[model samples]
Target: MTDQPPTLPTSMRAGRILGPGHTVVVDVPVPTPGPGDVLIEVARAGICGTDLHILDGDYELARFPMTPGHEFAGVVVALGEGVRRSALGQRVTADPNLPCGLCPECQRGRANQCHDLAVVGVTRDGAFAPYVVVPERVVVPIGELSFAAGALVEPLACVVWGLERVRVRAGDHALVFGAGPMGCLLIQALKASGAARVAVVDLAPSRLALARSLGADLAVTPDELAALADVAPLGFELVVEATGVPSVLEGAVEHARPGGTVWVFGVAAGDAMARISPYTLFRRDLALMGTFAVNQTVPQAVALIQGGAVDVEPLVSHVLPIDAFAEGLRLAAHDPTRMKIQFSFGDASS
Candidate 1:
């Protein structure tokens, strides 16, 4: 016999970005799961740089009047027809990328490059609310993991995908620009992937301190970036630009060793441009690449967190209730001391 389904609220308060720089919380009817989907009761949802872009209407894919949250962890509260992968009460997180299967990129196993990609927060309602409905195929069990760390799996998955694409040889020295949440994640992921030493640069002392504590061999402010050369006289084997600042990205290749690789993992403004000397890349034999949002790497991120290779809780500097959605987004956008900001839901209907 089947267990009785729990009662759910008809209406729930959700955060919505109506337009550029305009965000609000409104009471909307809770969404029902369609066939092949599962309804999740969100426990924690993170505010990412992408969310900031969406708030400012800077991300081309973001739709106005949309709820802006995709990185999240929660429990499966209800299951729709044909949903067998996720069951009621299963603790889980999901891959928010919705790539069209017919796309050539998808056929080639590059879903992030899907021409008609429909991301959860960008294209539809997301987890900045009590309930969010996603396809069962994207849901992955967290298996007793804390909801806060579970919420970080999505971002870490992006890191994992980048790692898979980049070259991380054993004992290679690396330099990373930016020590924010994604930057810190990159530091740990690089170390775990066999980088012998990692140096991080940031303008925030607090972030530098956190990066050092989290396994960075060297952490320095932008004013002291010259100190990095002392750690690697020949320059780092790998250089990463994680600040999403055009100027920072422009100079990243200068810090790479001859024949080294430069990984661009930042989310810069759509119209932003960075000038780099192609002659320098040609002379140095440098390989420059970029990885976008999570693409089939959630399972690896889950493994990294569960196996203790990555610590996500330390990156979360703020956790507020859904009532403070705007405050959370504001801090995420302007707070220099902030790392990861998340919204929690104690009362699912609240």
Candidate 2:
């Protein structure tokens, strides 16, 4: 970890979301970390579904004219007042959500539900810039893991938190609706959680093909769901709706066994509603649950990615530089075959 120069830059290049469907790369003043904070040189930033929502002005928590990128991995370049230099030059990824410690939700150990929730890349400027400041507490050292793997920790952490909320038992049968990056990760995590057989459902053959390569016992189109009966005659013990489509939830519920659990891990529109039969849930003793962002599971996620339990490399389909970020966003939104599109900046060590 090398010590940084005392004088910080006046301005740095950044991708800003100005208004709905409008974004551009602009020069923004480099932010100084407050006490108990550290500055990171952005290395790689992942484009996620939430980013699309933010760009569309659809995410409730996001404010306009801010740099947008929450999933990132970087190197610590400068330490702030009261912060140790131990992290200087160290590679790391972070949990973006910043909670008010005094909030009732924080007090209840539910910081994800914090009343005054401020998140990097949303409520505050984020890592789309070459350099950004973050609280020291949220940073997790990447150790020997690649920055690409590090950038994935946040999304994997979300899956870890969702697994905590959903009851996944050993030898349980699982069905994941969606073979997208997140859904594919959910498949691996569910398998790692001890599901005897993890079946996948997707509209795309290519995605489903990759799902098979990633260890999915069965991958099929919606019309082929009947084939899943060979593996689980009754129904899947755990059914996860990862597509974030209201109609998918209905199908997910129908795939759950009596007394099974249906976990909704995707982020649908704030006003979107999913219709499910209350009678079926009551009659079958089924549980329907939803999960939000990462809690305290980044470490476990790092372990999974670095430990090789979950494979993330194949999920990456596009790696564009910051200058082409607008094009990257467009491909991420419209490209059907693309899995994960990320923006990789300068060398993390530089």
* Candidate 1 per-residue C-alpha lDDT over 1-350 given as tens digits, one digit per residue, 9 for 90 to 100: 22226588878999989999998889999888888888899999999999999988889898888998999999999888877667788999999998898989999999999999989888899999989999888999999789999999999999999999996999999999999999999999999999999999999999999999999999999789779977888999899999899999888889999989999999999999999999999999999999898889999999999999899899999889888988998898888889999898965311
Q: Pairs clashing in candidate 2? A: none
Q: How many clashing residue pairs appear in each of the predictions shown?
A: 0, 0
Q: Output the number of the lDDT-best candidate.
A: 1
Report how far off residue 57 is in candidate 1 (Å): 0.8
Residue 174 of model 2 has an lDDT of 95
Q: Report the lDDT tens digits of candidate 2 across residue range 140-205.
A: 897888877788889999999999889689999999988988988999999999999999999889
Q: Model 1, stretches more than 4 Å misplaced?
A: 1-6, 347-350
RMSD of candidate 1 to the truth, in angstroms, is 2.0
Top-TM-score structure, candidate number: 1
